[model samples]
Target: MVRILTSFVWLLICFSCAPKEESIVQQMEAKGPIPHPTEAPDQWLLAHIDVETTGLLPGYHEMIDIGIVMTTLEGTFIDSLFLRIQPAHPERLSPGARAVNAFDAHKWAQLGALNRSAAVDSIISFHKRAAGDNHVLMVAYNSHFDSAFLDHLFRSANKTWREMYYYFILDIPSMAWGLGLKDLNSAWIMDRYQVKDEPHIADQHTGITGAMVNVRIYKALLQYRQDLLAAVPVP
Candidate 1:
């Protein structure tokens, strides 16, 4: 009987693990393998996105703030967006996180009640409008964390973020390593590019500031890659 029960449970788990059906948007977003760009290099757009949450893990945490800064191959700020949402699960806020983000009790209540679905809808719409046909190279400082949270949020909203994102996420930390900048970060990029108006707090502490830092970092990385390529030997 125990063996039979174990087999039944295993079968149930396998059923649960089956991949979800792909949505129509997801189908449309799929692309074939892209060929390498010519020496001139195709224009690459970068979107610096940041999110301040009540806790560390996505699906488990509540997002308090969100920001996005968009730039082109040349690093010019084409557009930006910032929004603060009332935390859905106020109790989720950790003391350390609150202190870092400075979202005290008073500050929290000031944002007033927010419609979570409406907020997500508005942002998703904005993201679509901003992105258009232009492929966005997302440049979050720690994209693993931010992307996980965003994915969780979209899942919670009954929407697949991968569909909206076109199934591509160019995380900054990984990009940093690609540029031989392992252990380097937003502050390093700022100093490398001599960017003015440094923030007093950590990038993750303030969503807007974090987004701006990501934008700057993308620019620095692009310039770094260009210089590196220029230094390469040719036949």
Candidate 2:
């Protein structure tokens, strides 16, 4: 009887693990690889994004703030969006993160704070409006850290993260490294290009400010790439 029950449980497990029908998007994704950032489409929306979290605890962190600045490839501003997400776990705020983000006990109750679903909706709406038929590139200073948090945010919010942004994320460090920047810090590269901003102190380093910093860094990197190509003698 025990053997029969085990077999029944095994069958149930296999049934639950079976793949479901793929959506159209999933089918399309399976067809080909996503485009790389270097291969810009005819029209593309570049969104410089930044997020401030409760901590650096990977999936455990709660996003306390978000900033997005959308624009064309030439840096023509399109739209900007900012959100303060009410933390699901305000108690998770670390000492360092608390100091950097500067969130107080009353901060989450402010008029700007949105719940996770609303925050996700706001981001999707902004990106879609700016993108249209153009590809969207989510640009961040250090994409891995930001993207990991965002992925968790979306998953936790019951939203599809891919719908809001393209598959390829453009990282500033990659460009900095490619251009021979030894430090690989956004501030260092920005200083080299003379892109000035307010100091990254406690309360002053807002998400919007961080996003704008990313935009300047991206613009500077593009110019450097252009200069490199121009300086290279054609074979």
On TM-score, the candidate that comes out on top is: 2
lDDT per residue as tens, model 2, 1-235 = 9999999999998775443223424633653455554675555778888899989886787888888899887666788988888878888889989889887647677656888888888888877777776777788887988888887777665555676567778888887888887677766767768997745787766778888878888888888888889999999
Off by over 4 Å in 2: 1-40, 233-235
14-112 in candidate 1: lDDT tens per residue?
A: 766443334534555576544322332343566778988888877777777778887765778877877776766777788777766766445656765
Model 1: CA > 4 A from native: 1-44, 186-189, 202-205, 229-235
TM-scores for all predictions: 0.74, 0.81
lDDT of 2 at 75: 65
Q: lDDT of all the models against the reference?
A: 0.69, 0.78
